[model samples]
Target: MILHGYWRSGASYRVRIGLGLKGLAYQTAALDLRKGEQKAPAFLAINPQGMTPALQQGETVLTQSPAILEWLEETHPEPPLLPKDAQDRAQVRAMAALIGCDIHPLNNLRVLTALRQEFGADQATVDAWAGRWITPGFDALEVLVARHGAGWSFGDRPGLADCYLIPQLYSARRFNLALTPWPRLLAVEAAAQAHPAFQAAHPDRQPDADG
Candidate 1:
């Protein structure tokens, strides 16, 4: 398998973590978002949406991190990302969705680029715009994690929620969002930081990382 993604992309980070947790070996094909490589004809053909985190297998190319992660979970099965219990699975999915659907989208590269190019947002203004969405979403996540958390987001094991949460936290820090208000989420972050899967998936560790 080959993962086509940019180094700092939060959605791409999710897939990296999932692949690591599942012990799946995959090569990476970097699409430099900074240079607009994702929109190039070759990549646009792979994913018409021109997004990062497209997973390519023998003949199948999957776009969208959420769908790719779900596919990983379904196809791999062992070291499952979801809890076996149905209710617990839903709760984990809810936490993942909170970040994936609500928080992450607002801070996507496309959205931020549009804000800067079209809406006259300066870097400082863009950072504030990012924090506006991240802070409240983290507020809700802090409560949910504290309520359901053992050490990780959903339980003691790092599951689906951690896969999503870690990347969002990374983005939050990127935008300079103050994380002091969310102690519970920080605890989850701490747990994930020590896990091998998360360690391997860190943006700084990627082949094409700017740092």
Candidate 2:
């Protein structure tokens, strides 16, 4: 399998973590988002959406981080990312969606760039825009995690929610959002960082990571 992604992309980070947890060894084809490499003709041929986190297995090219994660989970189910019970699985998926769908879309690179190019926003304004969406999403996430989480996001084990949450927290810090309000979520973040899989998949540890 070949994973094509940017170093700092949250969606890519989530897939990396999923691959690590599943103990899947795959080659990486780094597409430097800063250099617009994701939009290159070669990359677009693989993923017409021109998004990072596209997984290639033989002739099959998979796009969308969530879909990739689900495929990984289905193919490699030993270290399962979802819960056994149906209700618990739904809850876990919900928490993951809260971060992946609600929070992340608004703060993604394309959206930020649009804020700057289309609306004449500066860096500070862009950061503020990120915070505006992140803060409220985090507020709700904190409550949800506190309600359902044991050690990780859903239950005692690290699962799908953790995969999504950790990357969002990393992004939150990158945008200078105050994380103190979500102590429960922060604890989960700390636990995730300590885990070997997450440690291996960290942005700083990626081959294409820039200083």
Supply the global lDDT for candidate 1: 0.93
Model 2, range 1-211, lDDT digits (tens) per residue? 9999988999999999999999999999999898899999999999999989999998899999999999988989989999999998898898889889899999999899989999999988988999998898889988888899999988889899999999999999999888898999999988987999999899999999997
User: lDDT per model, in order?
Assistant: 0.93, 0.92
Off by over 4 Å in 1: none
Residues 49-136 of candidate 1 have per-residue lDDT tens digits of: 9989899987789999999999999999989999999999999999999999999999988899999899899999999999999988
Which pairs of residues collide in model 1?
none
What TM-score do all the candidates reach, one by one?
0.98, 0.98
Worst window of 10 by summed lDDT in candidate 2? 137-146
